[model samples]
Target: MASPGKLDTRGSDFARLARQITDAGLLDRRPFYYAIRMTIMAAVYLGGWALFIWLGDSWLQLLVAVALAVVFAQLGFLAHDLGHRQVFRTRRPSDIAGLIIGNLGIGLGWGWWTTKHNRHHANPNHEDHDPDVSPAVIVWSEDQVARSNGLPRFVAKYQAYWFFPLLTLEAWHLHIASVKALFKPEAKRRGPELTMLVTHFVLYFGLVFTILPVGKALLFLIVHQGLFGIYLGSTFAPNHKGMPILTAEDKLDFLRKQVLTSRNVRGGLFTDVALGQLNYQIEHHLFPNMPAPNLRRAQPIVERYCAEIGVDYLQTGLVESYGQALRHLHEVGAALRRPLPIQGA
Candidate 1:
């Protein structure tokens, strides 16, 4: 446990860093960048469906499915930015855009996802508080393994190997979770969210079934949804999956809590664009509202400050980040893999 004096110092650490970041204008919203980005995404989205229709009944439509999957994942990324308020200064505009992009554009529930995601940002890697690390189809820690039963227990011993394959269903999981969230008593804007979700599915399926034969439509749905899941899951898995998992006893200031448990992936512009600029996980965690385009500029300032404060900063190559996360998954399941002790040997 830290002394009271040390705790107070730690509390101010983030404030100092935040001041530096604000002075650099890194936290300012980039309306122009967002405008250009949203326009381009909209064009690509409409173009994708247009291509689908033009290629009607052809198996090459499978290729169109792949393209649209990428577009959907990209829309998901845009919605993420909206939820973070990176594109807008106020919650109203952000929420509105998030609803359009998340619900109407990609069949995700904006309110539900933002609520879940905000919790994740608030408590990244926290075993108890962060829903991202909570026990579900996959368990993140050994304690979760001990508490597990049924399907979760059945898969715990091999979760590392199952992780990527299971991501093929992540999109479906998200869609189901989104709909279920709307039924909760405290869900906000439930009527609008449900309406948009219904409209999205109706239009999405209606086009597919009407344009392609039933068999092709089914195949197209499977491919598109599967690829979208994999892409979105892969982008996020590298952020904090293998990082330190904190318990309730781990009392740290916001700076250390967010920084110590996040890992950054090293890359250039292409990686930045592909990962939706989330490659700067530490910076993103440190300043959740920072515009996506400004993260790259903020990286060096953050890295220097962390070093001056004697915090260990983690950054790895893209491939290595995934390897680290998968390795952690393997280690968490190790207890389950050990042979049962023989009685009365």
Candidate 2:
């Protein structure tokens, strides 16, 4: 029952809770479930785009385009899973799948995405690594929530308005240079990372210009891209919010930090429908190789781990989760100018 701030608590309490959770055996990562989920997302992306194209210059084309945007946002969720390595056994397979599906589905640069995502896991609460830790999405820490000395912080906090307007494309372009560096010679060697990016731009551009009418292309972009961004931003922000941040002094391992810092949202219908097994974040963090669907099954085991650690495994409904996310936005806005401590993943 001790709060996360309690340092005097013995490790035995945590050890016992961990044993109890593991003994319960509720956390199981299922590969097959993740596979099916990925397949579905791919299908939705393809189907939505195709439908928008087929609709041609009609209003339906615009409607479908909007849907296409939404689909892209949803694809971000799937990409998040693959990035976490929760969808497959091997990194190559997961990376390749993420490239093929994510590129086509969300116009994401797979190589860059994987690198950033890994960094995110490595520095969950660290400002330098996790650019996604913005007021536009996740809530900020107390320092992060404090006001800045100058315009950059002011612009960042106020710029959130433009976040939704440009949300779909912002992630890629906003962090372009940083992401592009990720595909440099050393990084690019990893399955020719940026190679997939060229292919993605080519394919989508070709489809938009040649295969589909100009009107249809425009519509598809609106629907699918919008949907994708909204969903992507929403789904990812909640993972770290409402949980305590860990620092270098914590002396915890990767798995322990994941349990203590990352949390599952009882996503209910959206858990399976939108995120596949990501709803079981604690288990996914504990065993990245486990498939998404299997993560749900691992819940009981995760519960035990929480108990042993004397840390309450956290979950809140979706509505409440977003509200918390919004709070994080304010907190993060405040922390812009403050110094953040280094921490392990």
Please tell me which predicted candidate would have the highest lDDT against the true structure: 1
Model 1 scores what on Cα lDDT? Answer: 0.92
* Per-residue lDDT value at 237 in model 1: 97
- Model 1 is weakest, by summed lDDT over 10 consecutive residues, at 1-10
- Estimate, for each residue in 1-345, the C-alpha lDDT of model 1 and write its tens digit: 234344325438888888889999999889899999999999999999999989888999999999999999999999999898889888999988899989998999989999999999899999899999988889998889999998888888999999999999999999999999999999999999999999999999999999999999999999999999999999999999898999999999899999999999999989998899999999999998899999999999989888777788999999999999999999999998999999987
Task: Give the Cα error of residue 93 in candidate 1, in Å.
Answer: 1.3
Over 1-345, each residue of candidate 2 has an lDDT whose tens digit, in order, gives: 345565335455445444544565533445666667667877887787677567655656656656665566666667767777656656888767777766544566666666766766666765445555544432355544453445445544644343455556554562354346655776664444455556667777787767567766665555655655666666665677656655456676655667767767785665656654566767666666555555666676668546645555777776677676556554555545456777872
Provide TM-scores for the models.
0.96, 0.74
**Residue 15 lDDT, candidate 2, scale 0-100:** 55
**How far is 272's C-alpha from truth in model 2 (Å)?**
2.8
Clashes of 2: 49
- Give the clash count for each candidate: 0, 49
- Candidate 2 stretches greater than 4 Å from native: 1-35, 38-42, 128-131, 134-139, 142-152, 156-179, 182-185, 190-192, 211-220, 247-256, 331-345
The segments of candidate 1 whose C-alpha lies over 4 angstroms from its true place after superposition are: 1-11
- RMSD list, candidates in order: 3.1, 7.3
lDDT of each: 0.92, 0.61
